[model samples]
Target: MRGHRPALRTPRVRTRGAAIAAFVALAPLIPSAAAAVGAQEITVKLPYDCALPPGPQRVAVRVAATFPDRVAAGEAIRPTGVTTTVELPAGAVSDLTALKATTVVPETGLALDVAQRGAKAQALWRGTGPARPVAVPAEGSLTLRTTGDAPAVTAVVNGDLTLTATDLGVDLALGTADGAPATPASLSLTCTLAKDADGHGLLATVPVGPSATPAPSGSPSPSDSAAPGSGRPTAPASPTAPGTPKGPTTPATPTERAKGRTGHAPKVGDARAGSSADRPPAPPCVKKNPTDKSLNAYITGYANVRKLSGASLIPVSCVQIEQGDPEIAFPPDGSIHLLQKSDAYLDYQGRKQTPPFKSTFLTFGFAPTTATMVLEQAGPMTVASDVLLVFPDNIAETYVRAPLVLRVLDVEVNGTRLDVGPSCRTQTPLSSPEPDPATYPGPHLVMLGKGQLINGTDATGYVLTSGGPLTGEVTIPAFTGCGAGGEDLDRLLTASISGPGNYVKQIQGQTCAVGVEVPTEGQCTEDRQPYVVPKPER
Candidate 1:
């Protein structure tokens, strides 16, 4: 049997027949050249949403601007191309319906050209000359079908969009398709110097007209305020037409000048605080009804000062006092006192800390027991007082305690009992040595001086609306702080404190009978005058 098997053949496997394939020769690929030196691209996101009916829609026409990094003064910087893309929401398809679309080309340094895409060619250009509006054909109004899922449609503007780079930055408004003035957004192009990899900077310059003369060396150069050695490049002068008159420069206002005087406190009685006669008439005080009672008052503002020993600025936080308790009582004599039950908290680094931290019973106390209020007919009702900010422990722990004195002045209540403007003055008195054991029971007290302290002047603008809430801005000037050993600190801290926004106090109810007696009509009028009420007879 084995011998007979030798003649057995291997099994044959049948396979499906294959079809013949055709081939064509293709061209070789070509690589593009690298971009030019100093070229940069900036892409901005344009987000838009529109409500549309059940159909396709075009919501926005997208555009892009390409220009040089820097342009010479008085020279035009034209966009390389203005590509427009008609955009639609997601999940939308074009219906091939004829509609109309329009957009105004900006009048700037560049020109534009419109180029159609395919043979379907439903869109038609409908504009005559320069400065004319552009119109295109569409199936439906952009305002209608624009409500649903649609994709972006792209086309090229067939005209010039140009602007002269006369200033540092040029702003272009984005218009709507209907030729309506719609500024969905704006584009800003800034001309800035280009820096090389080696840290060298390059700037472009345009020649002044031939009539123009080089500015005198002693006189301030147009770029004087600019960084040294970073002046605009000089170029050959161009011919200037005759009859071009140079305009006179306008002078800066006092307010403008005051900005330069940062860190310096304004004089106590500056023009801002005009004399009573010169001030505008105060708003009429809506007389409170017989049952109306005095409302509780709270002080809300900001505290900004340097750290005990640092050049960097400290974080800005809010300063607030809870209201009620030793109700802000304005005695008949116009004396204000607050043995406040609510604690004053300083929001420091997001942590709520009481002043004179670590010391129990030691709190912010107004000395002299009361503050005098000066009611003004034409201006604010001024409340002035001395605040004692006790810093019981020195940073180095060498000194037992330090006290900083600040004078706070508030003015102007346009409505109800709101005071929106205030000025503060802070000064460091000579630091006193450790207190004698008998005089100072618990710990030794020392004074903190200039190079060894934290202090500054704050200009605050506060708004106290009716129903007991406050808000304001606190601007602190450059301030110095000292090191533990009384060494000069490095940097000065300056900051602006904004808000807790929700800073508020509950208004405690009271009958007209309690506390200060309601002022009579005559008394109210008298209080409006600048005179203070004499202390009541004992």
Candidate 2:
């Protein structure tokens, strides 16, 4: 939940809903990485507060770089294979979703503080990556893992050259799935490292002392011993060290080049999620009761039409379930019913998850109409697992009745956009039609989901402890509210999209650990997910 925006607010007046987000929530840990020099491997995970338009959100960062455990004086203190992973919680991503800029490829700028004896300087750790745009995932935080080379330090005095982390800036280049500029422009987030009382900012320290092997005649003299980009040198460098171009014959391959104190310009680097191995163990997880009790959840329900070729994904609006609530039940002959079938407040307005149903839904099995379907949670749904304790088998079954409002956004009946306004959506919340009043239960539409305990747990059928797939079948009811000014679009869509045997498979992501303390470390992660979809019931 660190970067999750649990709520997706609807657009008031004909807002063009684009696929605003696409992001990969990758693992932060990179397996065993070694530097060519066989230096000590150092990794640090730090917390920072990043300033965005929606305010400041906590950002977690893991930095991995290789440096000599100890270095002799006059020797270069260069850190190799510098990789920094920047993470933003799903809540923070929700803010960007609201802004309508979803896909992002970021360029990062960082500076690590350097100090040795009395000399103080800084090392540039600019990170770049390829333009693989990362989307705002339906669930989980957005992660950017990148590696780059930085300016190294040269030990001058006979002391420790301390490397400390400092604040950083990240500019996100918003792009679409096709790698084009999104509706909105780019966004910039400023993250300042949280001050650590224990000097946790210190990354590594290299001891500067006598070297068993002395510097060669052309080694950097004590004159210019300043770290690259340090602005001031402790001493002047040897003529050959500074690329001063001594004589023509000696111009052969200079070992070191002149590094400007102004620092290197930020460039786009390969930022894809690379392969990993030898992943180190994460810190122990600790959970505490939290003040916030609502867990953020997303239901990416894939709805199938009996006539369509494949299942169409219908992602629902953000829903919340109380924390610590036992989402289990015991039932044999009955189920929990809502409003006794006569609720007056049943309407089809709670619609926010709006994306044009992709995979061509052909009108009359031939014509293609630009159609948009928005799935809405009409009422508070229940996710309860029936624990049948009397039988030899636990026979755990989880049932969910999501009161839904399915809205059709647009219809291209010979260019009828002029006849109906944006407010003219599929009128009624989904409702099953019954001819007789005696059998008419209520005016609400619902999708039914059932889960059976399989992996051997108290509540294995329905994913409550974490997220997994919950599959069911939905019989889409007829449509109504979409006609205006003689354009009978609702009747046309009802005839095409409604029917039984429609499979419903919803993928749920991990919760923000509502009952756990804020910033739940390992207990709340970005990638814990359900592996398979439950078999759709008849």
TM-score of each prediction = 0.16, 0.37
Please give the lDDT score at residue 125 for candidate 2. Answer: 63
In terms of lDDT, model 1 sits at 0.20
Candidate 1 C-alpha error for residue 402, in Å: 47
Clashes, model 1: 34
For residues 25-127, write the lDDT of model 1, one tens digit per residue. Answer: 0000122132223322322212223222342222443323344433322222323433323333332212111111133222111111111111011110111
Each model's C-alpha lDDT?
Answer: 0.20, 0.44
Worst 10 residues of 1 by lDDT: 14-23
What lDDT tens digits, residue by residue, belong to model 2 across residues 143-216? Answer: 88766555444543354456677766665555555555654444445567886413446676555553324567
